[model samples]
Target: MSDKFPDQARVVIIGGGAIGCATAYHLAKHGCKDVIIVERNKLTSGSTWHAAGAYAQFRTDPNAGRMMAYGGELYAQLEAETGQATGWNQTGGMRVACTPERRREYERAITIARSFGVEMALISPQEAGEIVPIMTTD
Candidate 1:
């Protein structure tokens, strides 16, 4: 290995997961050229590899939902910018309820999503199964 390191950098990131990479990308986008990302493993080899990649942003807290939504949008744009696929899918999502209390929870989540214009829907068990074919009503 070469015993040499870059002479200078404005920012040094310690991970190569999605968050770290995204931060690096944003920093670079804002004209911060001296950014270095140090990874113990290859890019996306950490927790990001195991991520379910779900983009559901149904939250009672509007700011939290907005942040998640922004992350999703940034992920979508990242692929195009880097010429690498981030495996983003917009198939939509559903939260099922197996009991009355759980149903109320789903209702509240749907309301929150709607308030943020997040484009979600409340559906029956059958509809949920249709969206996620592997799901079981039981």
Candidate 2:
């Protein structure tokens, strides 16, 4: 076990997931040498490792969509800087609509994503099947 960080450290962060590590890296890059990260498990061993790495910005809230977009960009930059694969996939995803209410929700989400400059398109059942060969149009 490593010694606890000094009492005078500028910042002390808990957890060692992608978010924590990224925060530490940015702080270090900005000349914050007194930053320390404490983790209960190996780095990226928690939620970060289990993340699906999907970059979809579809959400009903505009702010959330924008945040997701920013997160995707940060993840890309992190992978580039560390030369490690973060399993990011840029392939767009589709939310299947099984009912009228679900379709309305998907439409709202699509509009919010578009407001955040996220590229998305609405497709008919046939088009969706074309994109995902395993999916049935029914």
The true-versus-predicted C-alpha distance at residue 66 of model 2, in Å, is 0.9
lDDT of 2 by residue, 1-138 (tens): 447647666798898987898789889989997888889978888997787554466777878889888877776687788898866667767788899998888888878777777887778999988888999798
Q: Which is the leading candidate under TM-score?
A: 2
| Residue-pair clash count for candidate 1 | 0
Strongest candidate by lDDT: 2
List clashing residue pairs in candidate 1: none
**Model 1 lDDT per residue over 7-81, tens place:** 777899989988898899889889997888889988978898887575567776778878877876776787888
Structural RMSD, model 2 = 2.9
Steric clash pairs (candidate 2): none
Q: Which window of 10 residues has the lowest lDDT sum in candidate 1?
A: 1-10
lDDT score for residue 78 of model 2: 72
